[model samples]
Target: MITIAKPGLLTSVQDLGRYGYQKFGVITSGVMDPVAHRVANLLVGNDEKEATLELTLLGPDMEFSEDTLISICGGNLSPTIDGKSVKLWRSVWVKAGSRLRFGGCKTGCRAYLAVAGGFEVPEVMNSKSTYIRAGIGGFNGKALQNEDELEIGTPSELSANISKILADQIEDKKFAEMQWTISSEFTVSSASKPDVRVMKGRQYDWFTTDSQMKLFTEPFEVTSQSDRMGYRLKGPELSLEEEQEMLSEAVSFGTIQVPSEGNPIVLLADRQTTGGYPKIGQIATVDLSIMAQLKPGDTVQFVEVSHKVAQQLYLDREKKIHQLKQGISLKIRK
Candidate 1:
């Protein structure tokens, strides 16, 4: 169990996302950065889909009520246990009663915290994600606050074994992180403006040729109004070839829809099930992690890629993750 001492800005629980209910108009709420979320779980011997605490631009302060095995990934928010800095992308064994805290942001816009056993949050619609707007799922269906206590779920055999090994190295009386860690080379560092790869959307041709060129050339700034729902981007106005009435259609994560206002809205994890806006592009699965790291005021340029190349890039990423998963399991077994 753990108790929150300070709830930072917009901290919530998430997994991969809720599925099979989008036809019912349910919003898909989940971690903005899938790579970070998955890697954190893998480091702690949890299944990739297990729920993790998704920390936004800011994080939370909590005290552990029991010995815990955990890992932090993605954004670097300067996490410390008992005032000592902890390393990102590594496994950590924290002593019971220790206080964990965080400071200002360092890189990226979000981070993920995964424990050996997932958070003991109630699952709604088969997912533990917290959709705060609808007030469903996650620790009592809302963001964590000061004084809130969260129960830890039972750890798997692998998780227990890993913790048992780390326990022997805990001479500091508070916490100790493993020496080796996942390489940071694979992660997207949000230190500068990034170019996101995208494929033309199904409704791509509906936009004027100049607007299409502008998408790949003009830099777009993420607006402050953005959230998990969508990124409201500011750039050269995208105009349609001509006004045409269209029925509401299904929208997917990373759908870049150009509304009548000319600005594009890139739908994300919390996007609505259907939209009537014309989609000019779809972010490639490979670059979604890059897009997820973007924060308000960050600038981004779009790069066009063929769907075939995008699929290959996704395959390569999956292959790498598969290899890493096997490597971790083997290391733990030894």
Candidate 2:
């Protein structure tokens, strides 16, 4: 069990996302960076889809009521256990009554913390993700508060085995850490400025040739107005070839909609079901994780790719994840 001492900026419980009900206008609210979320869970020997605490910009201060195995991934908020530094991208065993805290952001804007058994939160619509707008799912559909107690779920067989190993290595009175850690290649680097790839949207032809060309060449700055729903980019004022009446249509994650005002809004996890604006492009699925790591004022340039290439990139990423899972399993066996 854990108790929230300070709920950092916009901390919430999220799984992969709420799915299937998007046809009925329900938003798929989940972690901004699925790669980080999944990797965190994997490090802790939990299922990838298990709920994790998604910390944005800042992180929470919590007290563990019981000793547990845990892992932190994505973003470097500089986590500490009982005032001592803790490593990310690897599992650490925290003793009961130890306080965990996060300091300034060293890189990235979001982080994910996964406990061995995952958080014990009731599922709404088959997902433990929190959709704050509707006040459903995940800790009563809201961010955690001070003094709020979170129950830990049952650990999996792998987690139990890992925990037993970590327990035997209890030296001194400090937290225990494994000598092995996941490769940095598996995690997003804090130093690199990513070149996000996108596929032409359904309304791509509506934009002028100049606008379309500039979309690839020019850099866009993420504006302060950006949120979970969408990121409003500040860049070239993209104009259409002609004005035309259009009906609202479905929009998915990473749908780049260009409104009449010419600014582009890249839809994200909590985006509305449908949109009427012209979509200039759709971000590739694999790049969405990188896109989510960008903070306001960070610049990102777009690179256009065919749908075939986009699908291949996604497949390649899945292969990497599968390889990583296999590596971890082998390490556990050793």
Candidate 3:
């Protein structure tokens, strides 16, 4: 068990997401950076779909009641155990009674912390992810706060073995980390502005040619109004060639919708099921992780890519993740 001493800006439990209920107007609330979430889980020998703590700009201060194995990935919130700095993206064995805390952000906007065993949260609609607005899942259907205690699920066989190996290395230290890490190539740098790639949306041609060109050329800053729901960009005001009323349609993650105001709103993990805005572009799946790392005031430029190429990029990324899992499994066997 772990107890929250201080709840940072916004901390919550999230898995991959909730699905199959969108038709009922349910939103899919999940981790913003799936790459980090998945990798963190893999490091701790947990399934990628297992629930993890998604720490926002800030993080939580907590105490572990029992020996625990953990991994931190995504944005660098600068986590420490018992005042000693710990490494991210690597598995670490933490002693019982250790105080885990995070400092000011150094890089990305959010981070994912995964334990040997996933968080034991009640599942809602077959998902443990929290959608706070509807209060559906996660720990009591809301963000974590002070005095909150979270129970850990039973560790898997692989997690037990990994824990045993790490514990032996810790010796007298509060925690110990593995020697190797996932290649940095698989990660997007939070310090750098990312060029998000997109494909033509279903309503791509509805916008004027000038608006379309401006989208790919002009830089857009993520407004402070942005949240898990969607990012409201501040840049050129895009207008359609002719004003026409359209029926609401399904909108997916990374859908770039332009409203009457002309500013583009990029739908995210917690976006509405459907939208009436004109969607001029759809961010590529391969670049969604990069977009997720972006924070308010961050500038981004869009680059167009063919859907075929985007699909290939996604395939390559999946292959890389598969290889990473195999390598980690071999290490555990050894």
Give lDDT per model, in order: 0.91, 0.90, 0.92
Summarize candidate 1's per-residue lDDT along 175-262 as a digit string, tens digits. 9878788766556575587889999998899999999999999899999989999999999999999998768999988999988999
In candidate 3, stretches whose alpha carbon ends up further than 4 angstroms from where it belongs are none
Candidate 2 CA-lDDT value: 0.90
TM-score of each model, in listed order: 0.97, 0.97, 0.98
Which prediction has more favorable lDDT, 1 or 3? Answer: 3
Candidate 3 local lDDT, 15-53, one digit each (tens)? 999999999999989988899999999999999899999
- 80 Cα displacement, candidate 1 (Å): 1.2
Greater TM-score among 1 and 3 belongs to 3
Task: Give the CA lDDT, 0 to 100, for residue 129 in model 3.
Answer: 94
TM-score of 2: 0.97
255-319 in candidate 2: lDDT tens per residue? 99998999999999889999999999999999898888888888888999999999998999899
Backbone collisions counted per model: 0, 0, 0
CA shift of 284, model 1, Å? 0.9
Of the candidates numbered 2 and 3, which has the greater lDDT value?
A: 3
Report the number of the highest-lDDT candidate: 3
